[model samples]
Target chain A: MVAAPCCAADDCIIEARGLTKEFSGFVAVCNVDLRVRRGHIHALIGPNGAGKTTFFNLLTKFLAPTRGQILYRGEDITHAKPAEVARRGLVRSFQLSAVFPHLTALENVRIALQRTHPGTFHFWKREATLAVLNDRARELLELVDLGAFAAVVAVELPYGRKRALEIATTLAMDPQLMLLDEPTQGMGHEDVDRVTALIKQAAAQRTVLMVEHNMHVVSRIADTITVLQRGQIIASGSYAEVARNPLVMEAYMGAPDGELRGGH
Target chain B: MRAQPVLYSLAVLFALAVPLLGIYPVFMMQLLCFAMFACAYNLLLGFGRMLSFGHAAFFGFAAYATGWLVSAHGWGPGFAILAGVAAAALLGLVIGALAIRRQGIYFAMITLALAQLVYFVCLEAPFTGGENGLQGIPRGTLFWLLPLHSDVVMYYVVLATFVAVFALIRRVVHSPFGQVLKAIRDNEPRAISLGYEINRYKLLAFVLSATLAGLAGSLKALVFGFVTLADVQQSTSGDVVLMTLLGGTGTFFGPVLGAGIVVTLQQYLSDVVGGWVTAIIGATFVACVLAFRRGIVGELTLLASRARRTLRPARG
Candidate 1:
């Protein structure tokens, strides 16, 4: 029950001190000391099996870290439930389970707003009370450029629109720090651009820590970048600095033999 | 949607005319009780997406409670029924807490095992009468004022209770909490990440479903003047599942229709085919699964929407 040591820097919203996760004998995330500055877009990029998702899971409390502590806003939330962490305004948009498919885009966002609403437990209240949230849900949908699909079920929307709807739902939670895992995975060039724009707009008012395979989107939007290899942080600095780092180049291209290309 | 109210009114009018046409009132009462049981099961299966194989634990336990109060303690029908419902809801809370720890098929299996445990408890318990059950329980008047000695009066009372409970179920389905329940059903992880303590919502829905099932069970005890171990048996649980699946899992009128069809088939089939009644029901369930996976009402909705689509003029 000891409190985690807080960072002296006032801008550090999230600090992970030697966070490690092991499944049986093999380590998935190893002693990764990390700091995420407030109101900055932080990107965690790694090759396949580098444990970016495993690390994200630990920070979100979806999985208990095998070792070390996680500090959120200077408070130790290492043992909190996903819902408890979310209630404190640190929320996550999952890979696939980020949106309710059967619910319409508007209804999906409405449920997020309803979570923080006082009348969530009022089963007997008139539907009018719920109708009052429609305007705000629609506003979020518009923000994600999903205004036309407001009435469509999340499942019926195209893959990119589904991703947009997920973002809208996450935005409805009004989170202080939004953790997005693979925000642009499996997308066409157009969708990747659209989601990249959405992420940039979202990061304006809140901190975002995203794990992305598409380094182009990350380089464009991320203010700070942390690169991992073999479950260990290889480099941590500004996006330009991480991109130019020889270690990161070696991890992505098998060896640091040539200059980095194509991602720009 | 516009045709819904007209359809509902017609159905109510038909229910009223059944007893007057000299149809057996007791048979109709059984249908009402079973219909309510299926609706309660449907609440968990259709909306919550949590299949509970042990719902008979709630229905059967309440029947025994009502039977004991009326026959042994001389309690009035209203108070006895209320007490039975409260006990069943408490049981639901305990069972739901345990069962919700698992997901999918495991949840169903856990509920089934717990229900079997309850069955054994009823078999060994003293006041349940084990094999004999509580027999010849009196159907006391409502509030001790209206006389329920007449079959016609009892028919009206059961019908009234059925309608009130049906309205309650309808209210819950359309409410905001119901929206949250549907969201949980569609995706549990998303609901949790949205900051909903989904286990609480699941348990609340379970308690409400159990309470309604209890109401149906208590009513059945008064109507038949008996409670048997058969009421709480695993077979009874299967019957409710069959009725719900046959009617349509998520539709409003599906369970009622399924209950009516199953109850009538059982009654007349037992008179003629005797031991083949189970076989006949088994065949019907197989047919339902193979030919009409969406059940009766679900098919009707599909057809209606199709018809509307065809009737509309094609846009240029």
Candidate 2:
């Protein structure tokens, strides 16, 4: 473990002490402690069932933790309603990049923007006629470099563009803390780089807690890395520190031999 | 776009002139009422992706409620109908809250089970006249005195309501909320990840659909002058599903087409085949599920789109 001193205030933004979630009789996520700071890109990397996604789910209030306390922005937010969590500005993205496929890309983001907007029920005008909402949606679309595909059905967009649109939809909520589960889970290397850059860009403004399998992506972009296996955070430090630890290598990171870390 | 609009205009024109065409106008009135009911049912099953077997609870409850108000208490037809709509929406709120906890096939089973409960209550309830229904349900008056007993006048009133509701359904479907409902249908978990409260949206849709269905049922009771037990039957619930599917899933006008087809089939099949409409309706449901999942309107929409694409001048 690299003995980098931890600043209590900066390090405790997402303090998870003994977080655990069990599905039926099986323990999908074991007792684990996780901490991520504001304005930092925190990557949670592990093999397929290393509990990274479960940990993220617990934080996002999608799944209630059987035993754990998840503190977001210094308040215990364990098991709050998903919308309440969203209203508090902690949002998530799915591995499959959940987007409204039938809707135009602009409409997808428009709905997202509507989720956070109070004036959403004005029925007289069409959604496209809602000038304020449309401009903001387009701005978010432009931010993701999907301005050209704004009018196209999301289903018609290529895979990489869909992922970008998902990011834009999440951004439309103006999330203070974003939880992304495998943002590049199914992307090619080129798409992975693009998504990683977007994540990095997003992290500059707020906080990003992501679950990644790719060591190279984590190593390249993560300001801090936490390795989990059997639900516990076995290793937590800078990428170099966690990447070097033998326990992390054996339990989580695989061989780091450049063949398949599952990382980009 | 042009073709669809023209087809829509023709449908509207036909709906307007049906009573004037002198083709047993009462049948047309019944057709309009059921068309609106089926459309309301489709609003959920087609777009919301929720198959409700208890929709009859709303339809029947509204029928009796509206019938009682207009016939026994001498309430205005419009006010009584509105009351029925509100009651069904409230019922939908309660039922939807419980039913949405489980999803897919379990949802269908739960709704069926709940509708059975409602059926039994109607069987014993005093206000429901204990399955005899609230009869002598005076067709009321156009404006409380104009007397809508004339078949043609009543038919046109039903016609106007049907057209308005159809337009309302169209407006809602193309709205932002409708898009969200479709998003939920295709991928609910994904919609949730996008910060949509899936259950809330679903409940709202269920209530809205039920309210509109109740509106149709209320109008139906007023048209026929009675609230029959047939309104709330499990078969009626299935009838709406069949209608929506035969018309088309997720297409705005498919349910209307399906409803018209089912009504016509019931009339003709009962008259010609005699004692076989049940078997035929069952067969039609199976065939639709197995082969014609897109129904008539859905197929037409697909054809229209294909034609539009082909008609496009070869892009350079």
Candidate 3:
């Protein structure tokens, strides 16, 4: 396989200005501004209640932003439905483990490929795109190193494998921007590092904005990091710079450098 | 070992055995109608994981449309069946588009309410022949003179329709579209994130299910030479769901077996228990729900999987 030509153009692929999300007087994300450039693996890190997931929901149109403007490729997408937003080359993975549990991993990828191309209502004649579809799905599964388990039911996979399959399935759509919520949520250190590497590989072709809590993983994979606290951006900078920020320290309960136990 | 061809042969042998056994043709025709109904209903429930509560709207509505087409305009049975199927497809399109606005229990309720509305429409429509229904209809031939009046021939006809529709469903469930429908059922959010227009797939599934149910109903009316308000009744809808669920929700051949069992049980119970048949069917539904959520086919498949594993060495 050829390497994806990395084109970190530094132009904002996703721009959020004054974004806010509230539910019945509870502010989940408040007045946050974020800019993610094309082909950059950006990470958002915060404490449990920092509203990273809420912000992701807003950006992907899973939930309505209380108030904000989300510009993707310089056009507004603040109010588009999830499908419409996805059709515009923006897709998101779920934080709480979203996947088709019954389908095989390869089948899952194939279905995603099928959805991307023509619909499945071809009532007569063989689907002309079958060979290409199968190959594309196979290529994605191999990228995630899930080629061995391609025919295994996704639900039957180990947690790490399932996470990898989730990422693989999303990547098969060839999105211009990928929003992943907690991609390494329950992974072991080795699995986390492996997935972080895989995420970097995927980011070679498109922009990747991820939500995470592991500082070391963030440091290794993210070109830039945003720290949020109480639904607000507390700090934003390079990994080394954010590590020294006093606000980042305070947000991590006064632990210097915002490092957690069991972190490499 | 390789049991697929043997199983296929067995199924074919059994289907062909119906005529040789000297069975009553009308009884087989009734079974065939319900079989198609269960299979079409199962297309959504088994594969789509959507248990529709108002299938009668399609089944009975098509029956009425077919009755109207044949009696009012003196159309042939083939054209009547086509008109009924078209009407059912349109109904499925409208109802599926609306019902899919929500998922889970809400989807079922929305379909039921829409079916009730259809029931009310049938009640008021002048062509429906009111409560007495459109009776004295001719049991028209297939095309011109296939002579559908012979009981054995009509029985074979019904059987053929049942087999074709069932095979088509089997073909569909294994197809890419079916794979996506299953994926959507298992995880809607993941499917949408993967770029599926979730509602469109769902609506198309609904329409397909509705149209096939219509085909079965249209054929049933032709075989019996009568259509009535009972076809449009709410109970008719509930019966199809019960039939599918009782046989199996996830298995391909489950609905076929389910419809056969339920119809046979109805026939046997009518002879032994008379008016208490409905109560018996209701009791069966409750039993199946409580004890067999996987239904007969799913449970059998589960058992087969378990057996396969047991016969093999454990993998580390």
Leading candidate by DockQ: 1
- Per-chain TM-score, chain A, candidate 2: 0.89
DockQ of each: 0.68, 0.41, 0.50
lDDT tens digits, residues B1-316, model 2?
Answer: 5677898899889877876677888788888888999989988888888988878988998998999898778898888988999988898898899999889899989889988888888888888888588888887676665568888788878888888898888877776677677778877866676667788778878888888999988988988888878998898998888888888978887888888899999987899999899899889889887876688878777788887788876552
Give a tens-digit lDDT track for model 1, residues B23-129.
99999999999999999989989889999999999999999998998889999998999989998998899989999889889999999999999889889999999
Candidate 3 error regions (>4 Å): A1-10, A125-129, A254-264, B314-316
lDDT of 2 at B233: 85
Worst 10 residues of 3 chain A by lDDT: A1-10
Best-to-worst DockQ order: 1, 3, 2
- Interface RMS deviation of candidate 2: 2.4
TM-score of candidate 2 relative to the true fold? 0.93
Task: Report RMSD (Å) for each prediction in the order shown.
Answer: 2.0, 3.3, 4.0
Q: Is the docking of candidate 1 incorrect, acceptable, medium or high quality?
A: medium
Chain B TM-scores of the candidates: 0.98, 0.95, 0.95
Residue lDDT tens for model 1, A94-200: 77647888788999999999876776756566656788899999999999998899888788788999888898898898999999999999888999999999999
TM of each candidate vs. truth: 0.95, 0.93, 0.93
User: Candidate 3, which CAPRI tier?
Assistant: medium
Q: Best to worst by TM-score, what's the order?
A: 1, 3, 2
